[model samples]
Target chain A: MAALDRSLLVVIVDVNPAMWTAEAAGEHAPFVPIIRHLCMFINAFRALDGGNRLAIVACHAGKPTMLIRADEELDRSLHTVLDTALVLVLLATPDDPAQYNSVMNCIFAAQRAAIMIDCFAIRTSSTFMQQAAHMTGGVYVEPTAQQELGLAQLLITLALPDRACRALLRQPKAHDVDFRAACFLTNQLLDRAYVCSVCLSIFHHGDIIECPACRSRFPPPPRLARKRAKRAVAPAHGGPVIGGAHAAAAGAGSSAPRPAL
Target chain B: MADGRDARDARVSPLITFLVGQRRGRLGRLYANPWTCEAVVRALPPVARHYALRLVALGDTGDGATFAPATLEGWSLAHDAHQAALQWLLDLSIIERAEQPGALRLNAAFREQCGSLLCGLRPPAPKPPNKHTPSADELDAHAAAQWDALLYCVIHPSEWSDSTGYDMPAALLEPAGLIAARRVRARADGDDDDGDGGDDVDDDDGAETIEVWAMSKRGATFVLQDLSAQAWHILQVYIGDDERKLAFLLELAHMDFGHGYELRDEHRPLIAELHHLGIVHVRDAAKSKSFYPTRLAAAIVSSGDISPGGSARGRAIVESNLRVYVYTSSRAWTAILALFLRLRTLLPNAVVASITRERIQRAMREHGLSAEAIIAFLTRNAHEQVRRRPAEERDKALTVFEQIRLWERELERFTAKEAYYLSDFDTLALFDAELAHALASGTHLWHRREPGNARLCKLVLHEREDVIAEARARIKEFKRSAGLA
Candidate 1:
């Protein structure tokens, strides 16, 4: 294959006002160091290839929006242009669940275009962003609060390679993807939830007759005799349960579920 | 110099090779020129370019004068990237090892000039503006026409009607071994082996076909490369034995396309030289005395995607049935197509053709074209219809592509190498000892003991002289010990 002459990089920053404020209350201002490192990383990428481009997207109040474009002035209200992007870097924190759909739409679109989405989670771990990175074959980095290995160091080491060079470099492997999807109804994380077979939308309640997404009617789920003893048999695990209905229900109700998928 | 040969053997990009092979004083002088420094930095590989930029960035900040080995560790570079970047820097003389054991200092001239260039601190040298400067479209047209004509002249000499009014110096190309001229008798003399019947036509009824200059293997490889790569290869050929000429040409790479530079007395010959190579176009031969750098010139130091008129993307439309429709009216492009395709018809805007085994084999055997080269050419010029599809499914002629590769592999199945054989040892002890010696030297190919003859053994292809002498001495010693001399 001919060498790639140009590559488009899209950086997604999670700008949750609350998280930044909480982080600022600590010794160091949280966003300041990250923003500085991000600028350096962008410069490094631009210096690497003159034709390489960058676009900055900010996830504000659960709404995924564009903050800056390589050519255009910074605009907070604009939607991201992900079509031409070869790599998407997301600086995420534990964000609002409400923006999950829009953020996921962007992630899926980037995935379809074969755009790698690298997620650098700050203090809080954003499960959905992790899923975005994992599903799209990107790196998911969670830098420790310690100053020894800073965000700039991680960015330079892990996220410098474009698509072509990524093939040669050894990427950081994601331990386990959090596949626990959010419910469409309440936006709550679901474990042992009912899946709308037609639309595949997860729901916390199994008693509903119709899928809220597809509006398809279904025959009632087979009712097994309630067995409390069977639910106690399986131990509580941190990972998402990957089994049929029986294991899911027992695993979900038994413990506080970890966010994933 | 040995460095030039090393560059040639490694096939380094022409610009970088030129820079690496220059004398230290000349190189420093070249870097002192801001335009040349900018062009050299632009032509560097991405990782090396990044390292230069990073160092310049550091110099911009009032940091330490030299970077310690630990500074690179702070960048957190991967092992391979760090090694590659350092090797390139050292090879290009961009950085030198410091007297201090673990430190490196950037080349002072390169650092200063490149920093100024990158930081936009140094304005470009003043050049007088001319009134008859060509537009971007005009420059593109001139580049395309001139480049196409040059290629057509090299590959299809009979079709060289001098339509572009640009004459390529065949003597100049001879040293590069890109094309070779051979005298052929007129077709009327009954030489039926002119299979294609394309370039063998007589100009006049009584005229002979005469000399036919056909493309050599290097020329085939040249034509198959992307236009930017082709320009670089040609430039390397033209810059042979002239580092000063290359330094001037490298400066041209930093010039903006469609911009006119006044033709100074010193630049006139160089400009004329560039005009011959299709890198620059003179605005007017009579009144106007300015030259415009074409897209080809600007593209040399920039990315490879900047083809003439942006037609590099998907120019040839290949159908699922192995038929091809190339959307180009240039005679040079058509001539290239004729190399491997059996042309059925030619339209004003396109040429219709199909892949035939006989035509492909003829190209492989006669023209020295490889299957990979053909595939690359097709892929580089694939039509928009094919390009718009997902990359995995884009090659509609994939089956034919595989078949062409298989055919090429068939031709490569047989190969011959030079080797020496050792045989007729005096005894089993001598044979075993010689075999051990050959095996120890790692020069042994194969060995065998003659059936029903325990005294004789053979070893094939031992290239080392010392091993052969030792084996001979051992055999003689064994013969003398047995009193059989």
Candidate 2:
């Protein structure tokens, strides 16, 4: 088993109302079924002796909060969710007003909290997942399917053992992980984006390529466009802004605010 | 103690504190207070944190070496070697060699310390024992008595056996002011009540049993439980370093004092039980001639191969070797150190005195001091300031690569200064041949041909006297063959 197998895992679920509602509409894993699967997986993890531990966080739109099952409720908690079978249908029904309200409250709170957190646009969004997995020694997987619980099975087979035991067995290769991350500003994935050299905030389009945090403009790579601008702009220092990619972007018609760290 | 104080005053970085504490078992205590090593602390070295965390995890075991090295290597301890960790535990008196070499054994003191710490951090497993469950109060009392008895034995193990006529003072035991057990005689005045005549006296047979005042099993068990894991560890480590103390501890195991009523040492039964707990080592005492302190004893008190010499603990022990050289300075070390204070030499930090074999043996034979007790005194106070080069430099200073080169260079210079035989050779070819031969024979330094002679070349080296002798002999041989001498 790899060290990850022996390490304690902490899962922070994005329980944002808007996000989960979108996911429930078949865009991602539906909230009720996803949660049911998560609870079962957590139970399975907790069953491990000596080396395994699990904790959960429900990240609502407004507030990211712990969803730690009460120690006393552990036996009934996960099992109850698992036994429900058609949990999504029950949760989606309009009859149970209280459950719907409580679930919505949790989702809104998590989303609000998550948005308030420092947001940064990422050209390649792999860092976020990589960091979470690295920190807790758990695999980070965001599933597109709400109906299937494939991730849980993957965890059971691959990520359950400790690093030591993992060394002896075949492990899921690091390369297999999707390294892409969604941009903080637009929440869209970008291929190549401008970044603040100081705070390393990525941007799609902005007036200044210079880092606002440090007031240091990124030196643009030399090119035909920059050379032409250099002659036309008269080098902004004692005259006009120098011909550079940053200067050109500032002059361009694109109107997107740069992302902040 | 000075080193510890200095570190505190310096406000040593948390990493350093952790490292120092790692050697001394202080970090384990700190972590017990719910002070977690925060992830964001910039001062903390990632590498050090990794090792410290692994050590803490390993310490959680019922036995100190609970996890194998291979198991740990996969975890956060990917960088460290198994031997390096084993060595540290050995230094801390947490792990040691079993009866056989290469086999790992856990010291009881380490087990208790780790167990309690881990238990405190995380609640104990909810599973109840399969055996009879005692009330909470009963458990507490049992633990207390066991600790107390162990402490008593640590302070005085001889009281467990009768072979040694001397009885250790009860006050020496921690949780002070306990009384020692001794046989009391029936009062002669009792004769006045029952005897009809001076020659005739009738007594109840039960008086013999009532005459002896001894510690009860419950009391012994409580005493052992009361002892702090640290102190118990010190005693465990102390006994192993010295041959005599080890034998005494083994003897306690053989006598089955735990089962019998006659207490030899007030703490003997407790120590004997500790041996079974794997804190101390005692082989089949009933059949064996004597017992020896396990690796646990040597590790807790003494500073040797456990941590490297340059490490804090090793350095401390090395420095303290002068006035009083204790193999260990544990409580046991202090007790032994006090036994042979020829004269007090007080330094600002450490106390110095000479604890001799004769003095220790005397304490054993006359004072009924158990071998483990004496070794503890030695280990706890071993001189920490031996005047030696640092461990790193000692080996690096004369590394094979540099030493050999330097020696060759020095010899070359000495040969250059002495003008020996090379000045006599007339031809460069002859000179080169002669120089090669001399160099091969380990004789020549520098050679240059002179304008006159045919057989020899101008040679320079520091030691001219020896070179001249050899040159003359060569010349003579040449003359005999060529008739040119």
Best by DockQ: 1
Taken in order, the candidates have interface RMSDs of 5.8, 15.0
lDDT of 1: 0.66
Over 4 Å off in model 1, which ranges? A1-261, B1-14, B17-29, B60-67, B99-103, B122-131, B157-167, B181-213, B241-244, B285-289, B390-396, B413-485
User: Can you write out model 1's per-residue Cα lDDT over A84-184, one digit (the tens) per residue?
Assistant: 34454555457557666666777777667677878787766777777777767778777777631355546755776665555545567687677666667
Listing candidates in order, what is each one's chain A TM-score? 0.74, 0.46
Per-residue lDDT of candidate 2, residues B224-312 (tens digit): 22122343333434443333343343233222111221222534544554443333333333333223333333222222222211122
Native contact fraction, candidates in order: 0.03, 0.00
TM of each candidate vs. truth: 0.57, 0.32
Residue-pair clashes, model 1: 5
Q: In candidate 1, list every pair of residues with a backbone clash.
A: A178-A260, A178-A261, A179-A261, A180-A260, B314-B382
Q: Which candidate number maximizes TM-score?
A: 1
* Error in Å for residue A25 of model 2: 5.6
